[model samples]
Target: MARRRDLHPEEQALWQAVASTVTPNIRHRAKTVLPAAQPAISPVDPPPVPPKLPAFRLGEKLPPKSVRPAESPLRMDAKTHARMTRGKLAPEARIDLHGMTLAEAHGELIHFILGAQEQGHRLVLVITGKGKPGREDDHLHRQGGVLRQQVPHWLRLPPLGLAVQQVAEAHLRHGGSGACYVYLRRR
Candidate 1:
């Protein structure tokens, strides 16, 4: 068991060569535990950055400040327009053209105003009966309202306003908010 002569010369030579060479490769392999790491990442992409937006300015006057705007033009809201018509009047002759075709109503309204002016009538009533009595689902028909909705727009026209001085919704006694009374300036 302790005989030095038992070792083969070729085996000893091979063992020595393998032991010396194996370590360099082993040390190298151990050093690379994590397979070659990638380069550190940059926050931004390369080149081609976007242009910055303009910042908002402070304390600038809005549209009304620069140019004078018109005053409160309408007297009533859309919902209340229907009720404003059937009210009281100040001796103005009123016309009700509700439910009529646009052409028919417009023609008649213009003709009536012109005739009123010729006859020296100052105040006039126009009742464009509220649109087709309301829809079944709308539930507005139970109120029995006047056609207050359409009158304001009709009166605002340059062609129509030329015949009148001032126009407003009538009091409840006259037609009670569903109708509008047109006041024509005595031409």
Candidate 2:
């Protein structure tokens, strides 16, 4: 993957300001300092030993992997795609996963999609906020917008995958860069 260009100083400052406003404040307790004391040990006593971690034995069986559906081509007619792009059809349900961790978002997405499919719904909206702007140091790495990047992948995995028929970016009116339209397979 190509590296993203660094944000200008002004842009970085603006992003920082915006990020600071949205993040929740955390309170930390002040540290307490204690006077140092010498350990009392007996000559016959074995040196205090550290705890040992559990060891994995050879040929140890690992947990089974979760089953995921195969990647099938998205099924949608051009007319439907055009209608979705134009924001002509209204979504039956909508889910916003902003401020959620990847695991949280994935679980919520699966539940939402599965529920929508079970309800016989055809179209839905999933909002994953376009992540925070990347810092200069994050150029070569996976930067912000974690949910935006992972949502599609999650939609293609397991139970949710079997239920989704098509996925498309939402129109400007719906959310432009931060949301998408999820068309579910008929029940």
Candidate 3:
């Protein structure tokens, strides 16, 4: 409990002077009931109050935020992309990441994409096999397999992103959500 100290004579005198100058806004002011007596204790400094923040307006738009560098936007020809996704164009080479851990898959993927690009292969298949269901941390997370979720990100990031031109989800015939189609850049 906080103990109220008796006011200093100088402070009391100043307060009286200020109180005398103020007129009550309401002529019929309600009488203030005094608090019950409290036990005395050493005075502690009070914490400072913070200033109020401005309220947000309804439907106000926020300032635009910087965006992350997303994968290169659809640089391949539309017709080729359509044909590839439709499984009409078969991948020249493919790599299955079904059983590999993240590290192994990443290394193999770098090798595969770079090799395909070196060999002048335009499109290649990367089978991630949609992740497992109901399980929390097996391979990773998502509708497809654990590798399925990470393959695209790895392709979009360093080392692989430079070698790859475009990455799209596989068609049902090719493996659907379980896999991706990686289009390699020309060497």
Candidate 4:
């Protein structure tokens, strides 16, 4: 009978660590000739790639928001107001609402009156120009004249009226029939 060959020194060291009757390395090499009973490691598939996205431009502008500009605080008929108040309320401190649209004038006048009272300004001149005189044939134009005609109505309102100590048409120099001096009560 023929005897099996002995393992080399290095192979012997590895073979001692593996206690199996038949070495796995020997089985791996023998696999080329014979079928393997069990495999060591399964093959791994590669990861999939992702799609690319479009890039943004460097100078693109954003959308604008819905916002309005603040209305001007001074909108009075200066000449008319000056004549009416007789310089009682200085030009710098008075609020005139002569040519302003009704809504714009109304809002600003209310704010000014309230603010002046709060700041302890007792004498305020609000010159609302007298309405345009109506021609004999056109009575409709009478109601729509200068702010002077309209301002008294607005001043009569509870908020505005409450702040005033007196309201009277100005003397000719201050504003004549077109302007009025408003005397505000101290807060």
Candidate 5:
């Protein structure tokens, strides 16, 4: 039976002895005071950032994508390469692999790179939109950009690599990290 009334003297003594022998739960430990000598740390400063994007307007027409001098082979000097990465040199050609399965994208990429090389094009853009944002699980059945992860590997392996001189992430206006600059070698 449970007691609602005060414990008997003998019962109280027995309860105290039993309680004293048991260990205290960690979550119920007494709070401790810290010594006052240590200094607090400040938040870290951010690294240097690139220039911000220009403001957008409703229904504004963008200028045509200028084709920079592409008739040359892919032996780019540092300054010219820098110019290309900064979106200063617009891509001579481009392809979007936004919603493709792995097999389709791989085949398309192979054909595109080889054709661009044969056509004597130097710099081409491959826009693989940053796949669905979050990590997907079985329940959601959502997939991230598999193409983005695989394209670079394909470019480095066989027939495609033979024509590729360099592959770099595209500049912000050129789709930022979502796209890549495939600098093709001349045939």
Candidate 6:
């Protein structure tokens, strides 16, 4: 095989410019740099291990006794409700649960609400797409709107329930029937 020739200075410069403009892989692990000086601690001593955090498992059920009864849906004063209705109170963060299965949405809702509370966010929006219209089958049976119904129930379950203070349907601009605003309790 023939050896490849080096690029001309102009070509090299152009290539450098193009490469600089392209974003580097964010997930690429960075090289670790060790310090020249070693710590005075004895070599026999082991490094301290950090405490393990409790892991959240999807679909794990909490003991019914441990979970508090679902609180009545929060009701704000007319002034506050009016403010929310008029879009005066904007959400600090938003999560869209569209296309997610019930289990997936439940897990995500738990994480989002807890995170928002930890961050001291007072309000956030959770978008659960208004499900496809129910088909006309038996007059007694209407289906769809699963997430719409289940979200409130999930919010009132164990860990997530503790984090949220209230929930209300969003204003038309934020996705009316398709979304709800979650009001998180202060940490």
Which residue pairs in candidate 2 have backbone atoms (N, alpha carbon, C) closer than 3 angstroms, thus clashing? none
Q: Count the backbone clashes (under 3 Å) in each candidate.
A: 31, 0, 5, 14, 0, 0
User: What is the clash count of model 4?
Assistant: 14
Writing each residue's lDDT as its tens digit, candidate 1 over 85-161 gives: 34423554767776676678778888888889889986677665544455544433323432344355566676776
Cα lDDT tens digits for candidate 3, 87-136:
89998899888889989998999898888888999989888775567343
Candidate 5: 10-residue stretch with minimal lDDT: 63-72
Query: Ten-residue segment with the worst summed lDDT in candidate 1?
Result: 63-72
Q: Give a tens-digit lDDT track for model 4, residues 1-187.
A: 9975655667755644553454345323432321133234322343575865323356744322211111112234566445434644443357767669988998999999899899888667677766676764443344446365557667767789788666666666666666666767668
Per-residue lDDT of 1-187 in model 2, one digit per residue for the tens?
9965666668766755764565332243333332233222222334577986334457865322311111234478878877887999889999999988878988899889998888989999999876787654343112347677678778877878889888877888888768888888888
The TM-score values for the models, in the order shown, are: 0.44, 0.58, 0.58, 0.47, 0.56, 0.56
Could you tell me how far off, in angstroms, the CA of residue 111 lies in candidate 5 after the best superposition?
A: 0.6
* Model 2: ten consecutive residues of lowest lDDT: 63-72
lDDT (CA) per prediction = 0.54, 0.71, 0.71, 0.59, 0.71, 0.68
Question: Which parts of model 5 are misplaced by more than 4 Å?
Answer: 1-75, 136-144
Encode model 5's per-residue lDDT on 1-187: one tens digit a residue. Answer: 9955656668766765765576654555554332233223233345578986434457855422322223224565778688987889889999998788888988999988898888999989998877764442321212335666667778878988789887877888998877889888878
**Candidate 1 wrongly placed segments (more than 4 Å):** 1-89, 132-147
What is the alpha-carbon lDDT of model 4 when measured against the actual structure? Answer: 0.59
Error of 1 at 47 (Å): 54
Query: Between the candidate structures 2 and 5, which one is better when assessed by TM-score?
Result: 2
- Sequence-dependent TM-score of model 2: 0.58
